[model samples]
Target: MKKQIRFILTSVSILLSMFCGLENSYSLEENVKIEECSDLNCVRSHIDEINKGIVLLLAKRMQYVVQAGEIKLKNNIVTAYDKKRAELVVNNAEEFAKEKGLPSGFTKEIFQVIVDKSRDFEQIKMDKKSNLDKIKTKK
Candidate 1:
């Protein structure tokens, strides 16, 4: 499990690094090696890089969710939010957060936002596909 997590994180870091088109950006290793955060700007800089990576990773994740929308449409699920699936993700994240010594509530809240965005994205894709199909049928 630890190996799997490490591999996944590494993959995501590579994908985020590429997607950000940040060939000129400071190397992540150099940026993360803060000896000490003595200044506000120092901490903010780290936060900025971390947030940028998170944003790119989330965008890629959303792409998968859009693909899931196609499958849901084909299966007649017709809803983006599968309660069981959402619960599974939340529960896993909550436990992982606890294991990592982070605040469970904060982690859960973040996961909730992610799940909400995923559901909305999927719905958007589903709607677009439906419209395209309608147009083809009409023609």
Candidate 2:
């Protein structure tokens, strides 16, 4: 039947769209350019320090985002605010990179992954809190 064929085609299209949506969230580029340096040792040391700084900064930002999520839950703030805060984290990371004479695009790509992970963590926290609240209400 034509209706059955159409239904199957529509289902396939929806599934493919979902898959593409997930893939688009991640960075697809494999290579990122770093500034060329004549002193290999200096470059290596600087990169090490930069990496440490980025990790520390990201951890601090995630902590704040988690705290914000808790406050949002308490106050019933909209989810869009939480997503905006995550975007701010990526923006800050890119600014930090530019300040340090590093490539902004590369740093932004790195922070995109960080943002995605933070969002996942925030979602898990939100889910657990909602479940706990439901249990309390039921008791």
Candidate 3:
């Protein structure tokens, strides 16, 4: 019960932070019953659900990163990679991992992958826009 409440509150907080600018306030469905994890199967199921939520958040972040690339292009700046920001993100993740009793090396490595993928995502966005511009010029 406690874990469910915590999960709901955490979800709510994330939703509020991400979509605060929007008009409607989001919330978890009141009709859904959150079950307690009493067995290994139940625990694994919850873990899977949590993983899905994390992936969703990552997808949203990717959208924002692409948008940032568009803004950078508009400003005549290249949005390939930002070394300082990447380093800061990994450093912060390492610190958080340590707090959660996770190995720093493993966390840093995972974050490195995330940073690399984020760079690729932004690059793809910038490249696509640039190609369209080139096609327009050629026409």
TM-score, candidate 2, is 0.53
Which pairs of residues collide in model 2?
none
Candidate 2 per-residue C-alpha lDDT over 6-88 given as tens digits, one digit per residue, 9 for 90 to 100: 44344333332333234332211223333445675855564455546545775697787788778878887635235576688
- Residue 69 of model 3, lDDT score: 90
Task: Provide TM-scores for the models.
Answer: 0.70, 0.53, 0.69
lDDT against the true structure, each candidate: 0.67, 0.58, 0.67
RMSD of each: 10.9, 15.1, 11.4
What's the CA error at residue 42 for candidate 2, in Å? 12
TM-score, cand. 3 vs. native: 0.69
User: What are the clashing pairs of model 3?
Assistant: none
* Candidate 3, 5-93: lDDT as tens digits: 35534543444333322323321332343454467686556556655776688779888888889988998877669899999999998
Worst 10 residues of 2 by lDDT: 24-33
- Between the candidate structures 2 and 3, which one is better when assessed by TM-score? 3
How many clashing pairs does model 3 include? 0
How many Å off is the CA of 100 in candidate 3?
3.2
